[model samples]
Target: MNTSIRRALGTTALTTAALLAASGVASAHVSVNAPSAAQGGYTVLEFRVPTESETASTTAVTVELPGLASARTEPIPGWTATTEKDGGDLVTSVTWTANPGAGVPPGEFQRFVVSAGPLPAQDEVEFPATQTYSDGSVVDWNEATPASGEEPEHPSPTLELAAGSDDTVASAVAAPSSSDSDTTARWLGGIGLVLGALGAALGIGATVRSRRS
Candidate 1:
């Protein structure tokens, strides 16, 4: 094989590997959309859950709220919402369940919204969640964030709280729009297609070069 063709093959392989790594990061675990809130203020937050099971639909999701916060859930048309409280009237957790046969199917995702706060004065708060599937399997997204900044296999979704200021407070609850989600999905799909094409082209080029040699 020529040196130039060998270098091209190596470059293509590296590019494809990088794209795969990025795609994995983008969709690895349950995440919060526009996950920022002001310290000691009210804000709405959305938990974005993607269905990961190939054979099971996601039937329910439960999010454990941060300590002793006042919370109200936004209604989702097809799901029923319930709250679990600790002894002294502090809302501890919230669960949303889909009606039978109406859960989020494979290859799709759903968002659960909650209006929660006055948020804690801390820099960040984590919302540990439990995801239940139609086949009775459960995925617990309760892993604490590591100090090394590497994501866990099932990391909990988190919201960063900024020190309250007039301008920061106004933009704290910027929930992601439907169009934004759609655009992200489209971009990921496009990258996957490009990577596949590059892999096939490289394979064909290698085969042709071998035959000539």
Candidate 2:
């Protein structure tokens, strides 16, 4: 084999391998594994954060609640947590701070829990999470507000709250419009008859024209 050809092939192979490794690294981050909340009541939510570092070990993590919503975090060993309250009657404020132990090695995962009360009046609620890495990096998981206002991909952790049965499910229901349905059916039927008559007349005109021609 020629020397130049061998060199080019080796370079191509190295580039391909590097691209694959970089793609995997770009996807790695801290994320919530599972979340739970109760309906019409306060619930403690737990988030499992995985910190993966190639060069530096994670020393601490800070999670900020959006809109300063009130929450209390469960304590972990070798870690300190705190909260901030709102002055007005609006949603309260809270935050969770975590510190890794000295014996903790690199690429370690941790868990933090928080308690929040009097959830909003929606059937579902989402908590957009932001994670701060030891290397001064931030990851935000809030994404892609759907058409139905529900995001499936990269969705914020969500809690489903079912409405009470006595809350009159009928009020939530939307009644079908009989007038609109009738109008649609009438338009379709009229269009069909018009098209059929036009087709028949065109066929008869073609037959007469052929006879004359």
Candidate 3:
């Protein structure tokens, strides 16, 4: 292969790799899944936790439920769910402990569900979580989202509370949709394909030019 064609191909390959890496990072995070819900109603919330440690599995997850009137956890097999309450008899936090060998392993994730609310009047709710690994490391996802719209390194999972009737809120939580990460991945993949095609065309043109020289 000629030098011009080889350089074009190399550049294209690098660009493609970068796009794939970005897509992976975009989706790797602890998140909450709830499509939409009313401001002052009840809804089921699912906390999605992904195991990040290669050496250990995710053994436990504790989520802080600030500003919530009440919450009841859904039973998960192989995991024990516990709740912490304050003097007001309101739940302050919920923790799910994995049974022996039941923790989420590397490259895997688990979702813990809870029926919570009398949703507050706020536009959104942030659930700060502490993830514990079998290796004894802890990850605190407690950062509040900033006004600049940039996500933090360990951002607290947030659920957007939309304006709807109480009945709508009940149905909203029943049907969870694709996350922001999925949408981002699709967009990135499309751009990568276009760039890759352009790179291949350039490489072919370069080869033709070299041959005519």
Which numbered prediction scores highest in TM-score against the true structure? 1
lDDT of 3: 0.84
Give the per-residue lDDT digits (tens) of candidate 2, residues 55-166.
Answer: 5444454454433234667767777776654443223334455455431235666667777654444677666666565566665656746889743444455556655333
Error of 1 at 85 (Å): 1.5
- Residue pairs with backbone overlap in model 1: none
Model 2's number of clashes is: 1
- What stretches of model 2 exceed 4 Å from their correct place? 1-36, 58-70, 89-93, 100-107, 145-155, 164-213
Candidate 3 clashing pairs, residues 3+ apart or interchain: none
Candidate 2 residue pairs in clash (backbone atoms < 3 Å): 70-92
If scored against the real structure, what TM-score would every candidate get? 0.70, 0.49, 0.69
RMSD of 1: 29.0
Q: Which of 1 and 3 is the better model by lDDT? A: 3
Which is the better candidate, 1 or 2, if ranked by lDDT? 1
> Candidate 3: where are CA atoms >4 Å away?
1-13, 165-213
Question: What is candidate 2's TM-score against the reference?
Answer: 0.49
Q: What is the lDDT of candidate 2?
A: 0.57
Please report, in order, the local distance difference test score of every candidate based on alpha carbons: 0.83, 0.57, 0.84
> Superposing all C-alpha atoms, what RMSD in Å does each candidate have to the true structure?
29.0, 23.6, 28.8
